[model samples]
Target: MKKKLISLILTLIQLSVDFSIVAASISLVIVIILVASTPFTGFAHELFDYHSWWSLVLQAVTASVLVFLAIIMFVGVHSLLRNINSGLYFVNQNLVAVRQILWPSLVVFVLQSLASICFRL
Candidate 1:
C-alpha cells in the first residue's frame, strides 16, 4: 500500500509538471510574438507604457530571457519527475536534470538583481 501511495503521488506530480511545461512553452511563444510584433503594433507602448525604443528593447530582452529560463526550469523538472517515476531517482540523468533546474533558477536571481541595479541607476 505504501508503494502504491508513492506511485500515486509521483503520478500526480508528473501531471502537474506536464501542465507546467505546457504553460511555459506557451509563454515562450507569446513572448516571442510580443517581441516580434511590438514595433508594428505599438502594443508595448500601449500596454506597458514603454515610451522609448530602448525601454522596449530592454523589456523584450528581459522577457525573452525570463521565458527561456522558465522553459528550462519546467523541462528540467519534468525530466526529473519522469526519472523518479521510472524508478531511476539516483541516476546521472536525474543529476543533470537537477543541475539544469538549479542553474536556471540562479540565472533568474542574478538577472533580477541586475535589473534592480539598472533601474536604480
Candidate 2:
C-alpha cells in the first residue's frame, strides 16, 4: 500500500510539472510571436522578393502555425486560471463538468477569418 501510494504521488507530481512546462511554453510562444511580428514582416517581404514561391508558402504556413499556437496558449492559460479558482461555479456544482467561452476560441475564430483574407491576397 505504501509503495503504491508513493508511486501515485510521484506520478501526480510529474504530471503537474509537465503541465506547467507546457503552459509556460504556450504563453512564451505567444509573447514571442506578438513581439517579433513586425520584424518577421520584414523578413516575409524580403522572402517574397526572392521569386521562389516557396517563400510565400513558407510564410503562410509559419503564420498559420503561430496563430494556432496563440489560440492554444490563450485557451490553456484560461483553463489553468479557472482550475486555480475555488471551483467550477459557472458551469456545474461539481468539478467534473465545466463550460466556458474561453478567449482561445475567439482568437482561433479571428485567425481563421484573417486567413481567408490572406488567401485572397
Candidate 3:
C-alpha cells in the first residue's frame, strides 16, 4: 500500500511538472515576443513609461532567462521522478541528479539576490 501511494504521488507530480513545462514555454515565448516587438511598437513604452524603458528591457530579458531555467529544471525533475518511479532512487546517478537540481538553483538565488541589492543601491 505504501508503494502504491508513493507511485500515485509521483504520478501527480509528473502531471504537475508537465503542466509547468507547458506554462513555462508559453511564458518564454510571450516574453520573447514582447522584447522583440518593443522597439517596433509602443507597447514597452506604454507599459513601463518612457523614462524606464531600459528597466523594462532588463526585466523582460531577466524574466525570459528565468523562465528558460525553469523549463530546464522541470525537465530535470521529470527525469529524476521517472527514475525514482522505476525503483532507481538510491543509485549514484540519482544522487548526482539531485545535486544538479539543487546547487545551481541555490547559486542562482544567491546571485540574483546580490544583483537586486546592487541595483537598489
For model 1 the local lDDT of residue 86 reads 84
**Candidate 2 has what TM-score?**
0.32
lDDT of 2 at 22: 69
lDDT of 3 by residue, 4-91 (tens): 9999999899999999989999989998998888777887667543446676677667667777777877877888898899999788
Model 1 worst lDDT run, 10 consecutive residues: 42-51
Where does candidate 3 clash, by residue pair?
Answer: none
Candidate 3 TM-score, C-alpha based: 0.80
Give one digit per residue, the lDDT tens place, for model 1 in 1-121.
Answer: 9988988998899888888878878887888888888878866667544747777767777878998998899889889988887889789999999999999999999998997786566
Model 2 / residue 83 / CA error / Å: 3.1
Candidate 1 deviant stretches above 4 angstroms: 49-51
Higher-ranked by lDDT: 1 or 2: 1
Per-candidate TM-score against the hidden true structure: 0.88, 0.32, 0.80
Q: For model 3, what is the error of residue 75's alpha carbon versus the real structure, in angstroms, after optimal superposition? A: 1.4
- Considering TM-score, which of the candidate structures 2 and 3 is the better prediction for this target? 3
**Residues 5-112, model 2: lDDT tens digits:** 755665565466457656657765654554455344555555333334554554555555655555455445445444444333454432232222345455557776
lDDT of candidate 1 vs native? Answer: 0.84
- Residue 74 shift from truth in candidate 2, angstroms: 5.9
Local lDDT at 121 for model 3: 58
